[model samples]
Target: MSILFGVVFFILGSLIVYVFQKKIFKGITEEDVVCEVVQKAFIRVKNSEHNEHKLVRELLKSDAFIKDLSLTAKFQGSIVGYILFTKIKVGEETLLALAPLAVLPKYQKKGIGKSLIEKGHKVAKNLGYKGVVLLGDPGYYKKFGYSSASKWGIKSPVKIADENFMAIELYPDSLIDIKGVVQYPKEFGI
Candidate 1:
C-alpha cells in the first residue's frame, strides 16, 4: 500500500515539474542542430508539412547534409522547431538549400521557426556557403531576405512556381552571372 502511494505521488510531482519547466522556458532560444533532436522533432512536426516523412529521413543520410549549419529550438530540452540545409549545385557553384523547416504544430507562430531560419543563415554564411535557397511562401520568406530565384536566373530542377522558389545571397554578387537549374542531391529524389 505504501509503495503504491509513493508511485502516485512521484507521477504527480513529475507532471507538475514538466508544466512548470515549460512555462518557464516557453520562448526557447536556438541551439546547435543535433541530429537526434532533428529526427525527433521531425516526427513531431512532419504531419503538418508537405514533404514526405521518408524524404526527410533520406535527407539525414545524404552526404550533402550540412549538419553543422542546421538549427533547432528547444523548450526545456524538447525540440520544438528545426531547420535543415543541404548542399545543392547550380551549375559549377555549390550552395545550400533550406528544406523541411518545421515547428511543432502547437509551437507555431511563437517565432521558433523564424529564429531557426535566422540562425541557420548566419551559420551557413560563416561556413562559407555562397547563398541559401528554398521553396516556400514568398510572403513569409521575403521577410527573411529571400527573393524570387528567377530574379537571379536560377531555376529549380523540377517545375515549381517562380514565387515559391526563392534565394538569398550570403555574399555580395554571389549569384552574379549564375544562371541554371538548381539541382539537389540524388538523395532528395526530386
Candidate 2:
C-alpha cells in the first residue's frame, strides 16, 4: 500500500508540472491572427457571459486592428495570452494603443502579459510606429517604460485619472511635440 501511494503521488506531481510547463514556457509570436480563436480566449478569460466576449469580437472587427501587432501567446498549442495594438489619431499624428490585453485567468500574473507587451513594443517600433498609448494601471504599466500622457501634453478623449492614461515613446522624444486629445476609433464605444 505504501509503494502504491508513492507511485500515485509521483504521477500527480508530474502531471501538475506538465500542465504548468506550458504556462511558463509559452511562445510569443505575431504570426497567429485567427480572430475567432482570440475572441474565444478573451471570453473565457473574462468569463462575463456574452458582453465581455462581444467587446473583444467588436475590437477584432474594428478598422483600428493593426494586423502586424495583434499578437497571440500560445501555450501547448492553445492561446493563453493575447494583446491587441491598434492605430489611434492624436491630432494629425497617429500612434498605436495597447488595448484589450487578455491573459487566461489561470495564466495571469505569470509574465504572459508582460511578455506580450514587450514583444508588441519591439514589433511596433520595428514597423516605424512612433509611440504607444494605453489606459491601464500606472503601477503595472510603468514597469514597461510608460509615462503619464499629460507629461507629453497628450490627453484621452474620455475623462479618467491622469495616471491611468499612459504613453511610451518607442524612440526617445517621439512624443515631444506630438500632443493632443488621443482619439480612439469609434468601435471602442467611448
Best of the candidates, TM-score: 1
Give each model a TM-score: 0.75, 0.74
Model 1, 1-190: lDDT tens digits are: 9999999999999999999999986765433234334544456543334444455567777888777865667899777777788899999989898986877767888898889998998898888988888988899999989999999999988888899999999989888778899989897777
Lowest-sum lDDT 10-residue window in model 1: 29-38
Q: Which residue pairs in candidate 2 collide?
A: none
User: After aligning candidate 1 to the native by TM-score, how far in Å is the CA of 153 from where it should be?
Assistant: 0.9
Model 1, C-alpha of 152: deviation from truth (Å): 0.9
lDDT per residue as tens, model 2, 19-58: 8987865763333334444555456544234343455556
Model 1 regions more than 4 Å off? 1-51
Question: All models: lDDT?
Answer: 0.79, 0.81
